[model samples]
Target: MKSPIFSRSSSPLNSHSSISPPLTPRRTFPETIMEENIDYATTIITKWDLDGPTYRKMSSLFGDDRKEAKRFIEGVTGLRNAMHYYLKINSSSEKLIRAQRLMQVAMKRLEKEFYYILSSNRNVLDAESVSRGSTRSSLSDSLEDEVQGDEIIEDGNSISEADKASLMAMADLKSIADCMIGSGYGKECVRIYDLIRKSIIDESLYNLGVEKINPSQIQKMDWNVLEAKIKSWLQAVKIAVKNLFYGERILCDSVFSSSEKIAESCFAEISRDAAINLFGFPENFAKSKKILSPEKMFRALDLYEAISDLWPDIEMIFSYDSLSAVKCQGVASLVKLGESIRVMLTQFELAIQKDSSKSPSTGGVHPLTRYVMNYLVFLGDYSGVMSDTVADWPLNAQTPLPESYFSSPISGGSAIEDPSSAVTVRLAWLILVLLCKLDGKASLYNDVALSYLFLANNLNYVVSKVQNSNLGLLMGSEWISKHESKVKQYTGNYERMGWIKVIMSLPKNPTAEFSLQEVKEIFSLFNSGFEGTYKKQSGWVIPDRKLREEIKLSLAKKIVPSYRVFYEKHRGKIGREFGVESIVRYAPEDLNNYLSDLFFGTEVSTSTKTWSSYETSSESSLSSHRR
Candidate 1:
């Protein structure tokens, strides 16, 4: 067909040449020329008309013959261009009617092909494969080539059959979608895509165990049931963000590569509600009143951590302005989780502060000590995540802690800056609170010596727990070392207060000459003091084996040598007057043997021992001498 032309008026070469020429009113094409162009457009449109008898015999023009599919798309483009020309040339032309009918047929055909490719290649065009294929620039280039009549090959074995099929299906979908959207059939195209893909997204999430649980249902759930659900959510969220939503985005972008706005709109429409519901679960769980217990805090932190860890994926996938609510939901969940955890931590600290168990343990590890240390050890396992949760939360101590409390040698006062030190300092502070409560419990003991022993036992337990657990890493070696030294100091005080009287009862000058009367008095005093101290201490207990042995050795070293010297020096003179067995109740070897049985918590009966007989004999002999 001959193309139409437009003529423009020119200014004559005169004095007005420097001035701009008047604009020309272009003449319209003649009726004959418009008819010729419309006829030519009709021929191209009819030759590829998808509903024609010849094309119908070949089902799926895009699938059965890609080269023919390329021509059909190009023919539709030419027909659309010619229709625009005819409308401007003769808006009421009878010849333009046939081309418009052909246009409708071609669009319906392309729509059917688009639906067929998506339905038949469900596995090949799956979200994971499409997402994977979208990363390759070659996939885009290959689609362009297919639109221009290039056959895809799978010869090199570089790509799997599944990958090759995925590439071909994606290329077909992109080519057909571009044509339909470009021709203003975008709404129809987007509707079909959203229907099928939205179902896939919802089903994938369901299979991954994600559900649309409301806040009321979650609040009423038993913790055991809720915890199980939380565990399932932790597993599902990773797949939902990184795979399901991500894959849907890639498919949308690839198919609507020609229109970014349409691609974003389609993806947001298909995945927005599911994404919001998926992320909103944690926030709902966090807001539930029943989940605020200290024991449940870890699960809350777990949800916070999963969201925190997956945030980058969540942000990138929902980067579209239309999908901003999905991203906001994720962030809101994290905030809720963090708030819940902080409240529980506050409650836990209060429990420690108000612990009112007044009965003293028998020089063994107290029940409070065990409970607090065990709780802190588990809390330490989550230090990395907990640090982020509590980074801005300062310890709100009722009594301000002195700088020396954090700086104390055994406090392991290493000020770790941001993100970690908050939890470390917080845990350390809880332990300190427990120690203070224990000090009060120690006062319930009437024996000053046993009170010190109680302090030694409980402190040793605390230091040992920190040493053996993740607390060691969080609290640092300096803290462990300093507290260890404190345990030793307690044991030393107990030794002095507990056994000093026995050690002091011996004569200061053991080897000095003394008359028989003075020697008898000295021997009698030694026997009475040693028997009473040993009997009382045998009931006290130390639970740790290493500390038990160490304390025993220390007491023996201090008391044994001095007692041995005094007993030997006075035995000879006293035995000559009274008999060695009557005056000497214990040998040096007996002191070491008695110290071995000291901390077992069972009282050794002195009633059956030689010491009781000596006490009776000495008292009767003194009575007879006085008469």
Candidate 2:
């Protein structure tokens, strides 16, 4: 035992152990995490253009090899430079006038094609007895041919004399977007693209000029089913470009070292435009220098900015004192268009990609991330090496690329990753809520479905944005509280005083997103009008028969404000002057506000009548009033 006691000098546990059993193996975590990082190089070629996936696919076809794409881009850059030179020279000379005239003729053909689209889509041109077949005959055999023949008019002879007249009437975007891809004429491409994309919106502007729908008419619109198609179409592209933009930017960052400029410019352009459109047009944007940037190629033609005529006829409707004449309807339409633009923008993006593929280069383009990392270490010395390497970034081609790009991950996906879209969307929701607020009594039956759709989309966006944030970033941390506060204020307004107040608070227990399941879940309820009039009438608190049994309970704290207003207005005429008999029945809840005023506004104290006295009160009152 003494020898055994001396045997454990290095271990204290030897002295403490009474009975030693077999030692259990100690479990430890592995020192190295065996994660096989997959090489995404080939797959990521599509991810490099932050503009979008559609853009990647469109541009990826520029060539099978580097040489073809570079050669194509060189020709494009040359064309752009030439156009700029022509414009500079044209500015002072009659040649400028000549260019304008040439623009007009091109526009006229574009207009004719647009009418053809409208004619094809609907019988709007039924006034002309034009069949779809006849229209196709006049244009091309199929929709593709129709689209191509109408838009791909490449030669100078296609230019005509309509430039002196207003160009707004023409559907020029289809042409401009095509030219951007087909010709590689970037400057003129951007210019005409701006006009053309905006021209699509001009149809809505023109629609506003049509006859107005009264509040009564809107109430009967059956907004739920009425809005189904537009809602679906709107959602189709709303998230597409943004999503593709993100994936592409991520790939670009991963793939090349000089993608910094392309990515940054893409992001800056998207952010600038998203902010402007969401917040309502900046009054001075037209005068700003950014108007000339590549991102605005489509936006330069953004008709939404110029078209205030579409806003609700606020000046005529609301007296400036009580209500702000926010073009309530116009606000909704513009937002809808914003959603629509995102979709149509897919075409514009696709065109850019297709054109970029025509250009070729011998050396491989650097991935975007390495470009950023090196620039960071060198403090921009490495940036000079990137020059003439990355090729035509959609945003900045000519100007000396920014020294150290701002918004390095500039792309659609990155833009969405920012809280910018959510903020813009919520602001749009705010605009709609304000419109609801200003409508007053007339708003009760207004088509609230669209408002709900806008709100739900934004809400979904917030949740989507939040998911993008983790331990590293929180959605609310990115100054999204500003957006929330702004949106909440508007939603609050509608809740306190308007219909949206009720709709949002409708207890999500019932209403849901428009999925197949929700439709199936609510269809029976919908047939019973649960989603329609039932939802509207849910606000009225029917005083129990017991309340009528005792006046005290009837006039309790929860008396509908409408009844209180009605009671107040008639209190003087009925309670004081006419002895509460002449107009009591006339003060129904229909005039809730006025009724609330009548009761609460006056000196009558509320108390419960005895059950026995309830009968006597009505009879005696009638008898007394019979005089």
Candidate 3:
């Protein structure tokens, strides 16, 4: 057979002359050996040439001719080998020119097929579906095997239809990508892939309701609107990090598994900008001045927590050096949120200390007590997040809490005992500030007994609040017990100061023999003192039902029994001398009836109306803070 390597005369190197040049002796292969090699290369390329009429009529190489797709890749490989062989032996050979032309035609076909597969499989290749497909390790192994000319085999019974479709499409993409990239057409392939995939990610974020919010826009928004956005962002961020960006990364890594440089470049170009914007929203929102109020502290903590919880995923997905800005943005949001919460906490403590409102006239719960306790209770619910935010934040050093302040075994040991208990100590400190303020407010009362009653009422409220909610868990049982004891002590003082005169009026022994004049003096003094005590305490109040009953029971044990014994013993003697109705004004049953009416808070004297106005004003103030 004529040697095909030297048989062609249509070569550009031969077209300029009709005669061949004089032969120079050189090492050469036998005609049969060179002819067989050239013939084999031409056969492979001719068999799968995509420029043939049949392939031209077809829509896509991968779609219309699935079997030929494998042959087509093999043909490109064969063409590449033939061109290299010809370049080494005869650089201007007609066979090399034909092989170069075929390579270009093959590249054009693969690029079109790559775009077709991507555009047609958008649904199957969505973020959720792709993430649900093969894991990165397995996918990379399969891609490496495919590059080495091994068919990737997956169990059809294992994955769902969507997952199977995604894997199959991904395999097809990587196959074409490997061939095209090997042939130096990577830029064309990457451009198409980047444009289509970037839009998908951007659309996914939009569907998730993540928007690019600026600080100025957040500042101008109504709190209600901003709160809604924060809520939306919270939900969107989880899906973005775990599914959207995660799946894109897996897909990119698998498709470009053959080239680490190209894979990192493509993944960063497609995902970095969107990820930065998604995380930057929280930072911008935290930077807004309007959300700095104490009332908005919870929302800021929620933002901090979402980023904190997703930190591992963020670190893993955006680990590339080019994606560092996304990680930086996420960290900045957390810092801004933590700073906002700390500022609000300071504002909250100041609001308690600076409260100038008069104490309630009835000596019931103060408005500040209700507001601060309720605020702390809500805050305690977020202890997990708050602990992280305030871990490094120590309490103010200038004010200097006493060692005994947190000394109770239940008050979290000592204030500085557990360095990890920053939030616990911070909350405890706020309550302490409130208690000190209540002590100052107690001084507003002129009547010593009412002042004690006020302290008892406010302290009892604080104890009840601590016992009822998450505060109980954070402050521990011992803390609640210690505060309860303080409440009891205040109530004990109240009982002594409020009714000492009435109790002192009775004789040391009610049955002691005495003259009618002495007995008359006793009855007169008892009548005058009991009436005065009742009139003075008529408007005082204890709002807590349980505490009110407890105080009443204590008083009954101390006052009612003794008074009853004295009254029964003296009544007949006093009446025999002076008329019973005139001297013995109160029957024992009458004391019980009056004590039941004590804490109703129905009427206050004009002298104490300033204290009475506190209820309305403080309630109004608390309502405004809530809004």
Candidate 4:
């Protein structure tokens, strides 16, 4: 997925320690104080654990409906304290000791910084926060991120005080969440939460079932018996999951790279639960209302066999609107229902298939079928080329990558060669888009954020100007080559969208069907744009009328009459509206300089004396200079 261009890991774990607020080394406080903090933290965790999923609903009990605001605030404070003690206690080992000292200092600094940040009163969905479910890391700076970071230091009005405060708090909240879920809560804890949640929902589902047909009246049941049955079902679910995902399948190739990777990831980075619905139909579940509803059936059938016998819609995201009627939408929930239904329906398929085969079918290939074809073309050897980092990504199943992740393919590839550059450009665009997206889904840029930094400083335009220059490409190439900074976010985003869509169309979860044109029209940018951009740019210049004539003649057999989509888009009416050719001709020197600047930052400074070559002159300027 495309990371924001300006993502800075606000977490103390960020490598760029100079910019980040320091973490206090968590030394053991007095035992009494440590005990109190632990008790408070445990209490809050217990409350959160018990509240289960309705914590949001219960938010109004506080003066404001800021869900768990007080608890969250207290938790933040207590967590810091507990972390201090935990670090202190674990500092006996050499490795743990070093980590403790670093964390100790970092936590103390963060505590002070956290307080400073919370004083602001605005929502903190700005560019500076939010990435990887949590926010803040040691990535290179983008203008958006740099400006935000600089604002705090410079007392600039890039962000309102309120917004800044919110961001600070969110950073802490996000960091803590990541640490807990990663090291403390763990997958087992998450599953336990899921089990409990499912038990509650199952009870409700049972009640719904009983209203239609009580377990007691089914001729073989009583209340305790039903309760026992439901309990067994819960146990079975846990067992099934343990069986399905525990060993080889756990480590198999998925969307994510590792064993503890996102299960739905392999189906293409969609949520694991979503993958089940997309690819695997609970073999036993059919039209049984207990597992599948008519409405759900309509949605799941969206991805069923198309008019083409083999092809299926490979990429189509089911929207919230599509799932409006589905009671719940998560892998665990879907699995619980689908698993049970599949077991029950296996026996009755013979009867159902007999009746279904008798009906005559009017047919045209479905949009999903086309999508699958498109995906195979797009994926092209990407799997073979995928990074080995998948093994390094620890288990994280609770959250899925956001749907909005987008980047150019050129960018994703560049990221492989050079991660820093990848982190830079992609993270920058991501933060800007995300900030814009979050701000009321507001105008894409606000005066305070994107617009403000743009106006406040000309850096953005400078970056763009350099980026457009021919020499700029040279500088970029060099920068990436030397620093190995990757900037390709494109490939990741395309695959993510493709997988999400494919999974959505499956018969597992009820989601609406969409056409191939609809899918491509919406997401074509991610998959096709980057590579397409390269193809278009590689031989972009017309070279001469001869070349144009030659191309047209060569393609005449298959070419459409129009050149709008192909040649003209890049040519840009060559008169006053300049295009790549213009830059290539008059500014190759400057462009190389620009690329160098982008890649090396200020490290590889260049002077006009070196770049001011005869090669940079227009034809008229060259003639005049010659005279």
lDDT of 2 by residue, 1-627 (tens): 376545666465765655677997863332111000011211232233234355434433221232333333333333333334456644564433443333333333233333333334332222122222222223221123222322323232332223201111112222222334333333343333234323433333233222223334433555343233223322322232232223223322221113344333333332223222322322222223333322332231233332333223222322122222233323444444344333333333332232211100111111111111121222112122112111121232222424121122223564345443333222223222322222331223244432332232233233333334321122233334444454454334423333333233222443223443333333333223322433443332212222112322222222334334433433343244432342243333433333232211111212232312222343343222111
lDDT of 1 by residue, 1-627 (tens): 433332223324433546666997764566445456555646645665675656666777767777666667777776676667767766776555666776787788788888888888888877678876876654452344534333344442356668767888888888888888877788888888888888888888999999999889998898779888998998999888888888888888888899999999999999999999999999999999998876677788778878988988888989999999998899899888889999998888877677665533467776667666776777787787788888888776765767445422333334454467788778888888888888887887898888889899999988898999888887778777888888899999999999877877776777778888787777677677778888887778898999999999999988888778877776776665546676777889998998998898842222332323333343343222110
Error of 4 at 113 (Å): 26
Q: Could you tally the backbone clashes for each prediction?
A: 1, 62, 0, 67
What digit string (tens of lDDT, one per residue) describes model 3 on residues 1-627?
Answer: 866556568664666666677996863564344445446545644544566655556667666555566767766766676677778888998977877776787787788789889889998987777776655335532333433322334542344567667877898898888888887899999998999999989998999898988999999999889888888888999999998888889889888888988999999999988998999987898899998887778788778888998999999998999888889999999888888899999988887777777776777777677777777877877787888778788776345667447523434355356543676678888889888998998888898888888888888888787788887777777777888888888999999998888778877787677777787788788778878988888878888888889988888777788778877776676665546678777788988887887887743323343333444454454333231
| Cα RMSD for candidates in order | 13.6, 39.2, 7.6, 36.5
Query: What lDDT score goes with residue 564 in model 4?
Result: 19
Error of 3 at 619 (Å): 12
**Per-prediction TM-score, please?**
0.80, 0.16, 0.83, 0.19
Between candidates 2 and 4, the lDDT winner: 4
Instruction: Encode model 4's per-residue lDDT on 1-627: one tens digit a residue.
Output: 646553556544555655666698774457557557555655544444323464454432222323343454455455555565656666464533433333343333333323333323213422222222122233211123323422432234455554444334443333432333333332432243233323433343343231222322433444345434433333333322332222112212211122233322222221234223322332222223343421122122211211111111111222223232221323333344434323332322222222211100111111111222122122121222111211122222222444222222344455456533332333223223322222221122222222221121122222232344332432354432321111112112322332333223222311334453443332233224323422322322221233224333433222212211222232233325434342213222332232222111111111123112211332233122110
TM-score, candidate 1, is 0.80
For model 2, the stretches where C-alpha displacement exceeds 4 angstroms are 1-180, 199-545, 548-627
Candidate 4 wrongly placed segments (more than 4 Å): 1-74, 81-86, 89-179, 196-627
* Candidate with better TM-score, 1 vs 2: 1
| Candidate 3, superposed: residue stretches over 4 Å from native | 1-57, 87-91, 140-158, 406-419, 514-528, 574-579, 602-627
Candidate 3, position 373, lDDT? 78
- Which 10-residue span in candidate 2 carries the lowest summed lDDT? 358-367
Residue pairs in candidate 3 whose N, alpha carbon or C atoms collide under 3 angstroms: none
In lDDT terms, how accurate is model 3?
0.77
